[model samples]
Target: MKRSGPLLTLVAGLLFALFLLALNATTGTRGASSYGEESPAAPAAPASASPPATRTAPPPSQSPSPSTGPVPDAGYAGRTDDDSASVAVSLRDGRAIAYFCDGRNKESWLKGDVKADGTMKLTGRDGAELTGTLTAGERIRGTVDVGGARHGFTADKAVKPSGLYRATATVRGAKLVGGWIVLPSGRQVGILARDGKPSAAPAIDPSTGVVTVDGRRLTARPVAP
Candidate 1:
């Protein structure tokens, strides 16, 4: 009976040890599964988005324009359309003077102002009238009235020697008023009027503007209005 009791106790201890081993194996399996299911390391934070690109503008310009106006002083001389008369016009300090002559009995002296637009209207003795415009080419293009006649003409710009001249004096008992139109060709078309009677004028020293009328020396000066 004693031997039987000791054997039975040994059998019981072996059974208990087998049960503990089984429980430890189950716990190890559960721990491995938990580790595999852990959420994937949180996705790396997305890089911050970049700011939208911006634009800039440019600057402005600063400059001036040009000028357009009339000339201050000028002179012009030419002949009538019919070539029957010679005309001379002079401009000085905004004033204008014109002379018309056929170098015979027809003659007139006119005077007026040169307007801002380069136009002129002049009146003279015996109903004589002159109207003209100064062109961009510096030429005087217009019409003249003399002895009740209207004539068209274009006078070119005249330099120093090719201009108008006048001489006034009393010769031997008669009043002499002479006017000369010295042309660009050095030709002179003039008349010496004695007491209102017109006649051919003597030749003049153009450089000196000196003329001897009926043996009396006189200075024919440049005349302007």
Candidate 2:
């Protein structure tokens, strides 16, 4: 067989190309190779970047309601009056309500304690727990659920142990009724007597006969007006 130089060269080139392809398969590596075919680098895997850390923010907190403005003290006692010509709590649900009355008649007056920290619970004769809070500026305010409805009230100035008073005396056909009161830091004493007999020491106010070291007073009245 006679060999053509050009034909022989063509055959040599094909063999070289096949050999390179085989070599690439054997290498199995990424990046550029001796064939200069660019290899594609296995698509680079996209580098993954981690989504920029997500940056998720937290939810905001809730704000309190704007009911009775701001309470300065949050531990104030209050006093109020009712339409029944009697004294009632001048505070409720942050306003005012009927205070403890004298036998529900609304006559005379009555007093009770509204404690701080919302623990002093008041119950009606029907035995319903009263709900309230003592707040600033010397006021007690909160809500009361009566008849399954909410009612509001608040007190301003409070009474320091205020109530009725009586005197140690007796008159024919006279009431001769009296009472007394002592403040948180004040002190006074009572002396009982019968038929002008000194059964006990008479309570005497150094200054005003009505006002003693206790700052409370006594009075006598007509039995029938």
Candidate 3:
């Protein structure tokens, strides 16, 4: 009985030690090394980075002003003649910015690019601006700043309204005729294009085979009769 008692006590001591080791393992696993019971915390999401300079808003690019190079558009083919006037075009936002003209020669007209809001701008020949805008029907009223003085100029493209005339008047109705008709070139176009009146404007020149309305020669449209 005494021996059995010592053996049982030894067994009891061993079981107690084993129980303490198990408790310590479980506690550590929960706080630090507890693989089964603890979960790793998630890292915070990084902040959204701004776009690169190339992809982000960039500085506006400067477009070089147009020059007197070969005209790039067919719309200008017959706009002016060598002895006539020159016209220039400027573009601010792709549409006609401004138009400049000098009637004495073909080298005079100039144009610039227009802004999105119809504001026109350009680089001037003398490094200064000569700009204008049309306000009324055909009236172009604008200014060019010379040095520091503002010079205002007003002009209009002439248009002819019809006068009194009928289709039956072969030659005798000047007062009954409408206004004169001219061509785009120096040559005249249709004789009866005016108010169907017989015109005293000018006779068709047999030498040049060209017609005229009033005194100015026509140039664009073909003349009838």
Candidate 4:
């Protein structure tokens, strides 16, 4: 009976130890499963990173337009208030070249600076002066004074066939000068000078810039400034 009691006690102790080992294994498995779940949460960090890329997309929309400027670089032509003369102006790099003529014995080639505020004043030979404001990129309104005669004018933007031209040559010991302005509607006006004496000018070929005055052949070149 004593031996049997001790054996039973030993068996009870062995069973208790086995039960404790099983419980430890169960706890270890649960801890490993919890670590795996937390590792998957690390991928959620990349999902949060995606919003910064979206934030960078709005800057291009705030950029300025390519066409916006203080002045336009083109040609402008218009008639004077009296309808007896015409004017054309071309601008580039803040400088301007202009032509004024009556198509008969009255003309001037004016050159000057274009101010930041779209104002300009140009002077030429024979006491001619032009003062104007660039009302817009495509329009100008001003007055021109030639030999004490003042006239108001308005000019519109010129394109293609409507631009400025010039020709210069010494013919028979005389300094001959010619200036032409072609309107956008293909109408033309110009002036001719001989030894500083003005006269009615002639028509010019837009494609070749060729014209003849007083039987002299002259090549008129496009003037951008």
TM-scores vs. true structure, each candidate: 0.68, 0.27, 0.24, 0.65
Model 3 spans with C-alpha error above 4 angstroms: 1-94, 97-109, 116-118, 145-150, 157-225
> Which sequence of candidate numbers ranks them by lDDT, best first?
1, 4, 2, 3
- Name the lDDT of candidate 4: 0.85
The runs of at least 3 residues in candidate 2 whose Cα sits more than 4 Å from the true structure, single-residue gaps closed, are: 1-99, 102-104, 107-116, 124-129, 143-151, 159-225
Q: What is the C-alpha RMSD of each candidate to the true structure, in Å?
A: 12.0, 16.1, 16.9, 14.7
In angstroms, give how far residue 4 of model 2 lies from its true place: 87
**TM-score, model 1 to reference:** 0.68
Best by TM-score: 1
lDDT of 3 at 123: 44
lDDT of 1 by residue, 149-199 (tens): 999988888887888899999999999999888877777888889999998
Clashes per candidate (backbone, < 3 Å): 0, 27, 35, 0
Ranking by TM-score: 1, 4, 2, 3
Q: List the global CA lDDT of all models.
A: 0.86, 0.37, 0.37, 0.85
Q: Of the candidates numbered 3 and 4, which has the greater TM-score value?
A: 4
Q: Candidate 4's residue-wise lDDT over 1-225, tens digit each?
A: 989999999999999999999999999999999988774433434444444444445555666544435776778998998888889999999999898888778888899999877889999997899999886587889999997899999999887778788899998889998888887779888878889887767898898888886688889987877
lDDT of 2 by residue, 31-50 (tens): 33555774646655566556
